[model samples]
Target: MATLTSVYADSTIVLGPLATEAQPEAYDLCEKHVNSFTAPRGWQIIRLATDFAPAPPSEDDLLALADAVREASRAPRPAPMPAEHRPRPGGVMPGPVTAPLPPPPEIAEGEVLRRGHLRVLKGDKE
Candidate 1:
């Protein structure tokens, strides 16, 4: 029987390299897993299947994936107002036409009249 070298989880658990004619220890791993499992490349990761070795994505592939994720995160968010809640063209806005300003503190009748006249002259009467 042919010996198999398979990995499980993140660790390299070599299955029996049991040779039909030889002992179990004669079972050395295949070239692919040998280079992958032993070397500690930062970005190159590998997953192995029982029958065949899973191809490790190249550095360019990983970089492209990372760039896509970053771009998606930075994409512009939708505006706060929903389409239905948005003010239609030529339609009145929902909030008060203008919020009322706080009234001035109580003052003598003469002062109040003078302030009123000044407001009118400045075209700021409300």
Candidate 2:
């Protein structure tokens, strides 16, 4: 995979490293597409000599990932609300109580084999 930058003023196309963010004027090309690219009339193509290998995770990247994981794992504290809106210490929450869920339907022939939300059925033999 490669990132390409087209210079309209210079009429040149440059192939370089993959960008971390999406650019308004840059394009990310696949290996097959990049290898078989064609420029417009009067346009020149320039390929950088740098290897486009996947970069290893840096210390800062690892530390940032760890911090994010820690933040996400920690339970979120409840935000303070107005006294009138807050529920009583031992009272039930003031909302409609949900009815108990009904049991699932009984399984049959076609339902014997299931694929996700679909059922595979056996066709009648001639």
The best candidate by TM-score is 2
Taking all chains together, each candidate's TM-score versus the true structure is 0.23, 0.41
Which candidate should be chosen as best, given lDDT against the real structure? Answer: 2
Q: After superposition, how far is residue 59 of candidate 1 from its true place, in Å?
A: 0.8
Tens-digit lDDT track of model 2 for 56-125 = 7899999999999999889697899845543433346566535433334455765555543666677877
Off by over 4 Å in 2: 50-126
Total clashes in model 1, counting residue pairs 3 or more apart in sequence or in different chains: 1
Clashing pairs in 1: 17-27
lDDT score for residue 85 of model 2: 45
Q: Give the alpha-carbon lDDT of every model.
A: 0.49, 0.76
Give the Å error, residue 108, model 1: 61
- Give Cα distance to truth, residue 67, candidate 2, Å: 13
As a TM-score, model 1 comes out at 0.23
